[model samples]
Target: MQISYLQQWLTTPTYKIHRSQLRFWFSLSLTFSVIYSVLALELAFRGNYLIDSDARQHVFWMQRFLDPALFPNDLITDYHQSVAPSGYAALYWLIAQLGIPPLILNKLLPTLLGVITTSYCFATCLQLLPVPAAGFIASLVLNQTLWMRYDLVSGTPRAFIYPLFLAFLYYLLRRSLLPCLIALALQGLFYPQCVFISSGILVLQLWRWHKGRLCLSGNKQDYLFCVAGLGTAFLVMLPYALQSSEFGAVITAAQAKISPEFLPGGRTPFFHDNFLEFWFYGKRSSLVPRLSRITPLIYTGLFLPFLLWKSSQFPLARQVTPKVQVLIQGIIASLGMFVIAHVLLFQLHHPSRYTMHSLLVLLALAAGITLTVSLQALFNWAKCSPKSYPWKGYLARGTTVFLAIVLIIYPVFTPFPYAKYKQGKEPLLYEFFSQQPKHIMIASLSEEANNIPSFAQRSVLTSEMYTIPYHVEYYNQIRQRTIDLIRAQYSADLTLARNVIETYGADFWLLDRTAFTPEYIRGSNWLMQFSEARAVVTELEQGIIPALSGIMEQCSVLETEYLVVLPTDCILKFAQRKRN
Candidate 1:
């Protein structure tokens, strides 16, 4: 008797109740999005010295927007700024005009983006299934998945993709031509790779499955819509294709294959020995990366087709709109781009980029519909059970309630603050550099150099974060700089150190306390790639104290527990003293 009432409440709402259900679900979806985003913001602002891991690479350069004096003629800053998408840069510049520095804005922007993504996702789910409850579940799943990933919280160009892409999907499904074109244009300006996926979807829409075979879409409106979308896509993508980078050409697969930067422990780590990892789960190469972790309940989406086949038993399945084909087209478009990206290699960026965002959106819709259908099925079974089989009704009701409880409480057990915020451990180290002249460049072989640019707002000669090797010209300079720094840091002669300091205009030398030891050299994979570093290890093992170490007490300007900073003038003076 209770089962019938529950089914009626879910499936047979009056028009006024249905409107209220829509309002309730939409509000819930937005509420969850706000909650997740607030948690990320908490970590982002938890410490004055914290930054999102990727923001250290992409956003550090944006500090120049507020003050042009920062990172002047800086190679690391220049390369990153040049590669930033125009629209993304402009947005930051505009925000900076309003006096919010990019780093602070970067921390706050994700909440707004998350809210927009939640709004569009909920509306799009409604177009697919027309069930307000399903929309809530879909947006809920998408929010949970996004919060777990670094992409959404990073506030980089890719963060714009979710809202822009979902808006494109929603507007297209609604047949709103102008809005869809605008979404496509914005996506191109923010993340151009998604324009290809949008184009692929437009092309695929030109066909229709009729009877047993596929044929061209009979409606003229379909052709008109697709042609307009494709034309807009072409216009937005043309600038990226024609424009050449000052950093020279993107590294080819042949080039990356030979470089240590692409090896197992290398910076990028693209080529893996494990087949499953390389083809299926590799961060760069995979078709669908992090499948299980995408959403805890994503596996339920796999049962959607089966449930749809038994639609008679799952009454809610019949309410799924024909527009659900948009989900299928999205999957095909993502997969098609994924395959093309692999064949073309890094030219399209990473293959995983083509699929991961779209996968989350598609799976969320499928899983939401599946959850609603399954619940209704259980309720139906309970309602139809014979009086003799009272236990069956109890089992059905228990299962239905249990599924709902798990879905609601799943987030509490999962880890929090997956925002991947990297905190600066050496406050003294950053304070030291922050006080230096803006033009001053610090030279270092220590991993701590990676955090210096963002935390100290000062330039470093080269650090692990700045060693991105996608552009041949930029990386070649970075590689040589690394080699030179390694040799100078460990050489017994002060002459090599003097030459490197002069060549890079390095104002200071930063060193780890253990920098002179052989174990330090042996443990650093980045340094070991160069023969100079390996030779230094051999020298240290033979009890050859480096010239820099011999003068450490006199040359040191500032000393911390783990680090020491030496002025270049001091090093140069020591070289002169040794010559006399």
Candidate 2:
């Protein structure tokens, strides 16, 4: 009797809620979303010096909104600012007028985005399965998947993709033309890659498999909606396609194939020796990432089709509306674009981008429906157990209790806020640079260069983080600067160091404590990209000291536990004194 009652209590929320009480489910879904956002915020503001890792590259240049003089003539800043989506940049620019620094805004955006994403996710789930519990389950699973990755917390253009894409799905499912067109336009402005996915979905909706035959939809409305949506997508994306960047053309797949930047262990590695990894799990190449592996409950989505097949066995499965076909259309659309992206390669951006975001939404819906159906089925089985096989009844009751408990408590054990917050460890170094003139440029081969532009609000000649090789002209200049910096750092002749400092107009040099050693050169993957690193390592191994190494004590303006900063003027003076 106690077991039967327990099963009723466990399944009541999903089974008892008819279509009218959906607000109850919506409120519950939103409550959990707020709770998840609260947890992420706690970690986001954990330190005064912390910034999201990707935001270091994407958000740092936005500091110019507050002070136009910052990062003057900086190669790294200009390139990053140029590549930023116009809508994203304009949003930050508008907000900067209200005096909130972009970094602060970046941290706050994730919480707002999470709530918006959750709201859309819940509504989209309800379209497919009206059960309130299913909506809650889907939103809950998506929040877990989102917080597990850096995308949401980064607050870059990619972060907007989730809510905008989910909004597109919800509107598309509702067959609302104007709102859907608006969603399509917003996606193109913020994250253009999704417009292709949205366009693909719009195109795929015109055809249907009816009675085992693939046929075009006879409804004229379908064709009209497709044309309108496609037209919106094209207009929004045309500017990006037709507008030529001064940085030159995007790298071709042929060029990328031979470039070190695309090789294993390189900055943006896409190709891999392992076939399975390259095709199935590589971050840049995979169709679907193993997100379900991390949040195991998502694996339940795989059972959705099976449950629908045996709809007679699960009462709630019958409530699943024909709109569930939208999810199927979404997956098919994603797959279609994924194939086209692979064929076009870099022209479409990463192929994985086409599929991964949409798959997250599709999987969440499927998982929610599947969980609700299974819960209802288990409850029914448990009720019959006492009248029939006693052992079978106990098993059903046990499994029901277990699943409910795991769902409620699983997030407690999973790590929170995988935002990859890069904390500025050397406060004194940042302070020293921050005090310098805005026109000053720092040259460095140290990883610390990646942090300087963000933390100190100063320009760097180049950084590994800023070395995106897409635009050939921009990358050539960046590559040459990197090679020159490497050669100067490890050369025995002071004249070479003097020439590099003058050519780049470098005002300061940042260095790792171990930068002069052969092991440092050999171990640095960024440094190894340049052939100059090998020659430097060879010289260091032969016990030859670099000119900069001999002058560190004389030229250094600031010192940290792991780094040294040298004033360029002091180094130049030393080189002149030696020349005399």
Candidate 3:
């Protein structure tokens, strides 16, 4: 291809794309979506009915919709089901009514949602930039960002945030009021946090920048659009406001700061001593970055505005749409909500939730535009100096090709998109526990306890993985269980062990074969959260004979190298026989 042809495509690719151009853009976007969809399906079927970790916490209770007998009288199941959004639950209930299993639906939904999300992302970016290639590249970057996390693959309430939020943006840009309202309502129904973001945009649209000052729009349609959109948002959110969860009041920042469960190494581990993490990355106070790690490309979005300002160096920079202002409105609104969330503490939910989805969408678009502009700038420079120094042109074009490959190709090599948060490996263990009575409660501190509720259809007294300390009543109960389990496991007194089983009404006591060792307690995050457990650990280190350990071989109904399951009844019977 001639350098002039490449330059023309980079600089001005038709504002109203040619039929052929649209096909090329759609083809690239579709290819990326299909790759992600296939990977997600493969991951879904990779193990023994594997579910994402967050999905386990959110979607496991939905199985009851298909089989009413599942998770009967289970705290974790009941709590998650109770807290799940009315619309989210209803959507799955409707799917289950089609005779599809929840697991099957969960696996299948991501592929469709991924396509919908990508389509809207592409359209929204196109609406902003008008270049179909920009839209395609934006969606490509978005797919990469999403596949890195569990949001899309989990197919939980959070999964809808991307598609619904992007749909809202697309409709808003098109000034299509009815569809926008529906997207707004779905956002509230599905992911609630995103409704605030949509409302922010609506609110911003009512105010227009004119003559170098921000002035309220006098346009009647603007008022109507804002009114209709905000009204729909209010209607959807009102139900949640009126409803109450049996889990009790959400935990406050004051309460969380004082609790061990929110401290370092605690279950939620939100409050960090490190300043950067505590303020900017804290789950409750931070922005989109609440996690300990994320793809490095996410940071490129921070430099988007700077590049836009210096667009003069490259003519291709002119393609960035003025509608990029909408994303700025979203960030401003997200930040405002983030501040309010911190001020109100748990009343508004995690601060990170408010910003994460919006920021990711914005970042992906910005990164896409930035990469496009940077490559175009380099390519354009290469052609300009071809005659003066032919080597200069070759050098510039070679660098552009290398950089383009790295930007476009980097995401595929990072990690397997399908290897999500949780997967089931021990089929024998799952099958054995799943056969137990629905009302049976298993008690354990081992990490395996985390999998039982999802795989085995039983309640765990507590598990280290899912002890999100957002509710005082729930976390307190879990906290007490952690303390008692640790105390009972390390005590030489047989009565102490029996009391634990009686107090929790535990049907089975799942234990690691080497749970009595000093390392187990020291390594256990849940146990170490309580200062009381430290004394227990110290006693065990000095070789205290654990009453539970002595009875394991006699009472265990099943034993593996890694774990043993002791029936509480058998344990009590063994103690009685010994006493006799």
Candidate 4:
């Protein structure tokens, strides 16, 4: 009766099922979507207080999305739009029509992307293995990684593109070319790097298929599908290509600015680093050595051995088929990409943000191989005259369940004290900003400036400065004028201090204590070393130091030394002192 009821319900137009056996899949997908949506809403409501720099930028842009006309005519030209991919901006612009706050949209969109991507993974696995357990396990495994959670919470543009790229791959595997092409083109808009890597894999797959080396069961439709998809992707990229003169210049500049020495490392080869670090290491840490940045290669190494073992388990005929060959080729191509990336690009101090797509692909391949081999090994152990091993069945089942939990729940819950502010400082920052006047000109380190608006509710100029130094080369050619303006405006502390008093006429300065440390302020020496610095610091500095006792005489501390204000003339005097 239950089965009949389920069948009847699935037959209903609102819950239509094209495949009789897929009734449960529809229910499962709907359930997952609901759960993911709820979690996303919770995260958004909780707010990303920990790493609010990127989040705040998204919010600010989302605000621009809400009121497009509010942005200056040179807004796009100012940042050299190439610094960040344009997809998120475009999406925010579209979503703004719905009147949702930037924060809400940021959380909601990524959550939806996550759910859709997970569902697509399940669907793709079903086609390959045609087993419910395999589909479920695949979905669970892919979701278990720290990578997904990091992307989900960071609110970065790559987070939005990652899932879409995966979904496109799934569609391609199923011989759905038109949809694949559409997805491919759209992904280009979000993150071209992802598209580049994904397309490389796809092209390799197709080449294997063409040479009769891959044994796919599909006919002409599959070939047409792939061609159409690739064609569509090209077409979609055409507009951007025409605009490429500007884009190309930016890319060249950014590449030039990246130091060839620092490699951003995280969990690699699966277990070298914990699952948590692999996915959510946040910013590059000094504690994590340069060699550690290449940890992702560890996953690649593990995958190769596992793939060899898995291939040995299959008969030669099965392994030789086009489909299997294509899969093998894909694995190899992905690894090759990773190796090249590690040897060349990874050492450039590029943030995980830049490597996320590659990371996702590499993880997917590694996890897929690991799950396949581990499951096979467990099954063999369970069946091998298990009378010798009393708890073999239980052990196998338990192991499977444990892995499932790791893949599914770990991402959902691991790194305990999830969503809390870093060291509980975010709330203090938030409270401080909440009390500030509007449209204040804040001169501080890039991270603090980017973070203040989200935490405190005040507007800031040049909060994106941190990205600026890295993207200086690109900005020089594409956004030269704006770059010049920012440089001229904030080149010195005196200039910034004076500008704060004159231009925006700001009454307060909210400075992060860490930002004042020599290491943080080293590059902006003019702001730190001027003779009038004592006076500016006196007004802005909250507490007293024995060495700088008279400094506080000229100014009174505000709410805390973390925040202070000075007379407009005093700030101007500081600027003139430096000039003389």
Best of the candidates, TM-score: 1
- Quality of model 4 by C-alpha lDDT: 0.47
Q: Using Cα atoms with residue i matched to residue i, what is each candidate's TM-score against the true structure?
A: 0.97, 0.95, 0.92, 0.66
The 10-residue segment of model 4 with minimum total lDDT is 261-270
In candidate 3, list every pair of residues with a backbone clash. none
In candidate 3, residue 405 scores what lDDT? 77
lDDT by residue (356-471, candidate 2, tens digit) is: 77888788889988988888787787666556577767777677668767766777776764668888888898888889888998999888888988899988888899999989
Clash pairs, model 2 backbone: none
Model 4 agreement with the true structure over 1-580: per-residue lDDT tens digits? 2223422332222123345446565456446545655654564566345433355444554554554433243332234334455676777767778787665666566556667767776666544444444445445444434233455555667566657766776777766766777778778777654555556656665453446466553556656655666676676667666663432232232353242212132111111234455334534321122222232322532453445545655221122213433345445554555445434433322334334444444455444434544455555556563377758766766776675465445543434212322222456555755565444444433345556554554544443332332333443432333233233233334564554446444444444444343344344433332223334354334542321112233543433445433334554555576678
Show model 2 residue runs off by greater than 4 Å: 1-21, 290-293, 385-394
Position 183, candidate 2: lDDT: 92
Q: Compared with the true structure, what per-residue lDDT tens digits does model 1 show for residues 1-580? A: 4777766655542233557767887899999899898889888888878998899988898999888999989999999998989899999999999999999988998999999999999899888777777778888888888887878899998899999999999998899999999999999999988898888888888888899899999878789888999899888888889998999899999999988889887888898899999989887888777665566786687788888788888887887878888878889999999999989988988999999888777888889888877877787787787889888778877886787687667777766536778989999989988998999999999999999999999999998888998999999999999999988888889999999999999999999999999989788877776778889888898998889998888989899999999999999999998888
- Rate residue 492 of model 4 by lDDT: 31
Rank order (by TM-score, best first): 1, 2, 3, 4
Per-residue error for 473 in candidate 1, Å, reads 0.3
Error of 2 at 176 (Å): 1.6
**Per-model CA lDDT versus the true structure:** 0.86, 0.85, 0.79, 0.47
Q: Is candidate 1 or candidate 2 better by TM-score?
A: 1
| Residue 398 of model 4, lDDT score | 70
User: In lDDT terms, how accurate is model 1?
Assistant: 0.86
